[model samples]
Target: MRIYISADMEGVTGLVDRDDVQPGGRDYERGRRMMALDVNAAVRGAVAAGASDVLVNDAHGPMRNLLPEDLHPAARLIRGRPKQMGMLEGLVAAHDAMICVGYHARAGALGVLSHSFMGHEIEDMWLDGRPVGETGLAQATAAAIGVPVVALTGDDVACAEATDWDPSITAVAVKYATDRFAAELRPEDDARQAIEDAVSAALAAPLAVPEPAAGPAVLEVRWQSASVPATLAGLPGVTATDSRTVRAEGELPALYRQFGVWMRVATALTNQPPYC
Candidate 1:
């Protein structure tokens, strides 16, 4: 089986703040190592369960959190910025299954470092008119490509959300979300075991994702600042909705293509220099 893994840093075991995932911070290096180790563990499980190929996507800040030398030798990595599909880039019809590793809930959720996409830059994001966090939105995009999201590892809230939206998928809930910056978390060994078990179960009885919302999808993002999408309108058809929400229309792929561009604009506007 070919597995596509989208690894995010926020939901890794022991992560609790932005400083952990940001470069040059006191804890970023240590946290990045942990993130890589977690991904390695999941790869171990997938390989043991008969997976022949695995592609890991470093889906975090700067998209360069994982060290190549430290990654599993059997795995291929999709690393870069401004990807065509962003979080779901390496995922395609060729992959047998997908594993969403180290993900968290939406911005306001009770999960460690939880946020939908751009965190504080984006207040909320929706797909086809329903509120969805990063996990849900990413999975929906994967669904469009005909690949099943076999396993997901994250905090309690993230797994819970996955349960309601995609119950057939395996879950490894490693932390109990206390708030965005804090969590009642399990030790690394325990979390690793949970992830391993979920991977095994997922491989044994891989479940198909529910049908994705068919074409002509609508995308909206409620930003922290209303001006975000106003700038996006300049990027083709992305338009502003009232003040907070930005609206766009198309099929899943087209809307996400447009959405990714808008997201870039928002990131540029919200980015702050070290002096700031």
Candidate 2:
């Protein structure tokens, strides 16, 4: 079996603030190590469960957070940005199963460092009338390529969201969220062990590819700033559904392509000088 893993920072054990994941944050180094450790654990778990090939995607900001020197030797890492599929870029039809490692909760959810795509730039997002966070959105992208998300690891809220999306998928919550920036964390060793064990168990069962949404998917993006929606509304096939909400309609792949572009734009706008 070939396993694909998408690893993010915010959901890693002992991480809770932006400073943890962002480059400027005081704890950024620690956070990156934790993220890499989680990925390594997943890689080990996948290998233990008979996965012959493991591909890990660095899905956090800068898209290069994982330290290659410290990563597991059995897994190849896909790092850096401008990826065609963003978070799910490394996933493809050739992979037998996927594992979403160290993911956080959706925007407004009670989880450590919880936020959707571009953090504060995006307030909410919906696909085909169902509200989804990073896990759900990434899963859809993987599903498009006939990959089933077999396991996920994160905080309590993220695990709950995963279970709600597909109960059969294995979920491991390394922390229990007390609020957005705080949680009762599991010890690093324990979290890693649990992640490895859970993944091994999940891969031992028969996995099924998830079905894609019906044709002409509609994506509703609610931005944190009215300017974002207004800017997107100017694009063809995109309209402002509300002051801070923009709507885009197209085929799944096309919509996902555009959505990646939008995320980049929003992220750029997020750090501009107030005068700009």
Task: Identify the leading candidate in terms of TM-score.
Answer: 2
Candidate 2 has its poorest 10 consecutive residues by lDDT at 267-276
**For candidate 2, what is the total of clashing residue pairs?**
0
User: Which pairs clash (backbone N, Cα, C closer than 3 Å) in model 1?
Assistant: none
What is residue 208's positional error in candidate 2, in angstroms?
1.4
Candidate 2 lDDT over residue span 1-276, tens digit each:
999999988889888888888887799998898898889999889989999999999998888899899899999999997898888876778899999999988887878888887766677899888898898877776777788888999999999998897777789999999988889989999999999999999898898877877677888989878777777777898889889998888876667889988877776666632101
Number of backbone-clashing residue pairs for each candidate, in the order shown: 0, 0
Error of 1 at 90 (Å): 1.5
230 in model 1: Cα distance from truth in Å? 1.6
Among these predicted structures, which one has the highest lDDT? 2
User: Stretches of candidate 2 above 4 Å error?
Assistant: 272-276
Cα TM-score per model: 0.94, 0.95
lDDT of 2: 0.85
| Angstrom error at residue 226, model 2 | 1.5
